[model samples]
Each structure stands twice: as structure tokens, then as C-alpha cells.
Target: MTEPQAYLNGAVIPFSEAKLAVTDLGIVYGAAVTEMVRTFAHRLFMLEEHLDRLFDALEYVCIEPPLAKSELKQICERLVEQNAALLPPEQDLGLTVFITAGHNLPYLGLSELETCRTPTVCVHTFPLAFELW
Candidate 1:
């Protein structure tokens, strides 16, 4: 079986490689927001509602995601399809869509605000442990 996949900053990559830099504001200042959705029979649950709340939080925080909600929905669906294949028919996945407050260049004493100001967007999935929940 192939490795599970994740969406990171507009790219689909191996889940293991989906990482954020240490200097990211999400890490440094805890400036990040996330929404979690689960699948049922490989179908997303209340996806539109989840996105609505997520976008609202992003707006309140003044962080503009790099992609539109439509595009992000596509990515989430694709990820669910790809990652869900790795699980047994009875198992489902929990998807996490998160956005960060870009990097903390001032802490690193870097002047490339243009490059560092782009928010980090990621969508990842994990098999749900129903027993634990």
C-alpha cells in the first residue's frame, strides 16, 4: 500500500513529510486555527458546516488562506479519497484543516517579510480510533 498523503501549502505530499518550520508563528506564538472533520463510509461529515466555521475564524484572525474555500474543499475531498484507501472498510478518518499565521521573521531577524508572510495551510488525515472516542 502507498503512504498516506497530506496537503501542505498547495501541494500534495507524503504525510510524513508534511511539516512546519520551527520559526513558523504557529509554533512560536501559537497563532493557528484548525477544524476537524470525520468520514463515514469514506464520505466527509458536515464538510460545509466545518468550512464555514473555519473560514469565520480565519476572518476574525485576519489570516487569509492561500486558496479559496472551493479549492480547499477540493483538496480535502481528494485527501479523504487518498487516505481513506489505506484504512479498512470499517474504519474512517479524521481530517484536520489548519491555517497558521505565517512565519515569525522578526524573531529570526530576517527582513524577507514578503516571503515569510504567506500563511501556512495544511490538510491532513488520521485513522479514527473509535474505541478511544
Candidate 2:
């Protein structure tokens, strides 16, 4: 099977390797806000707006993302290029930004280092599922 491309944090990843811990606060506390960036002719449209919204969500919840928006734009561009071959010349691609606070067990929850206030950003490519029709 062909290796699927994924952008997790700042690295290019295999889709199979885009793994997250089960104990993540995003899962347990639903402490995550997401942004969906649709593509226009295989390029992301209004990416800045989507990014701004994602940041707004984080700020609203008081979670600071480890990576700045500039860093994220760089990653997003890379992900698009890495997966360019898979997308049609005229087709659109879907870029999703998901950031959730990290998880901490009851024992270490009090520590700032282990606190769930820092946001974890995970970016990935997605196909246009048929369900939207």
C-alpha cells in the first residue's frame, strides 16, 4: 500500500502514524476546537481566516498552542505539497486543524508542566467524503 502523508505538529507523518494518546484531554474533557480549511483548485482557501478562528478558540479556552501561526502556516503548506500528487489538478483538498489540550492523570494534574492548558495541534489531509452530498 502507498504511504499516506500526514502533518503532525511540524513533521511529515504516515497516516497510520498519526496517533494520539487515548488519555488525551481532548478526548476525555472534549477540550478541543477545530478548523476546517477547504481547498480551491488543490490550494487552501482563506487559510488565514481559518487559522485565526482556531487561535480564537484556543484563546477563549485559555490554552496556548506550542506553535505560532507562522509555524503552522509553514506546516500546512508542506502538507499540501507532500500530498499534492494525490489530489487532482482541479479538485479541492481538505485541511483540518485540530488542537486539544494535553492529558494529565489525576496525580500530576496540579503541575503546570503537566497541566492541560497548553494546546496540542495536529494537522492532517482528508478526502472529500461522499456524505456531504
Candidate 3:
């Protein structure tokens, strides 16, 4: 079978290998937080504003990112670079910030189990499918 063209876990990948606990809080309780931003001319036009909003969402959800702003920015840039070949010249890019609260093992049908938070950070590219201008 062919693997996914792109996948990332703190790095870049061209395979479909990702680990997610079945009882993860993100899966069980559906606890997720994210931010979306668009790109134009191969650049994130309002990166600062998008990041500011992302930080606000983290504050609101109480999830502390492990990396500084610069690091995250690099990741986002990499996503664009990796996916650039799949994009059209006139197409814009989109970025997403998806974080989850690890996993919750409460209903794993076991009483002696505990769940921990496993945060995931993904910087991927998507074409502008929904826009109003």
C-alpha cells in the first residue's frame, strides 16, 4: 500500500504513521483547539495577527505550547515548502493549529487506568476552499 504523501510529528514526513491513543482525551472527550490562517503570494499575510489569535486560543483552553513563536513559524513555513509542488500558481495556502488534550482513559473499561495529555502540533498546507472576499 502507498503511504500518505505527508505527515508530521514535530518534523516532516512522507508516510502515514501517526500515533494516537484510543483513549486519548482528544479522542474520548473530543477536546480540541485550533486556529486557521490563509496565505497569499506564497506568504502568510497576517502571521502576527494569526499567531496572536492562536495564543489567545491557547490561553483560553489552558494549553501551553512547548515551542517559541519562531520555532512554530519555521514549522509552518516548512509545511508550505513541502506542499508547494501540489499547489497552483494562483492558489493560496492555508495553515491550521490543532491541539488536543492528550487522552482520557476514564472509560477504557478499566478502573486502574489513568490518561495523560499528549499534545500534537501540525503545520500543514491546504488550498483555500472557503473564502469570502
Q: Give per-residue CA lDDT, model 3, range 69-124, as digits (tens).
A: 78777777766665655767788777776667654656554452433544556555
Instruction: Work out the TM-score per prediction.
Output: 0.95, 0.84, 0.73
Better of 2 and 3 by TM-score: 2
Predicted structure 2: lDDT: 0.77
Model 2 residue pairs with clashes: none
Per residue, candidate 2 scores C-alpha lDDT tens digits across 27-108 of 8788888898877766788999899999998899877888988889888877776776676676567888898887656634
- State which candidate has the highest lDDT: 1
lDDT (CA) per prediction: 0.92, 0.77, 0.64
Model with the higher TM-score, candidate 1 or 2: 1
Clashing pairs in 3: 24-103, 24-104, 25-103, 25-104, 102-118
Reference-based lDDT, residue 66, model 3: 59
Q: When superposed on Cα atoms, how far off is each prediction in RMSD? A: 1.2, 2.6, 4.1
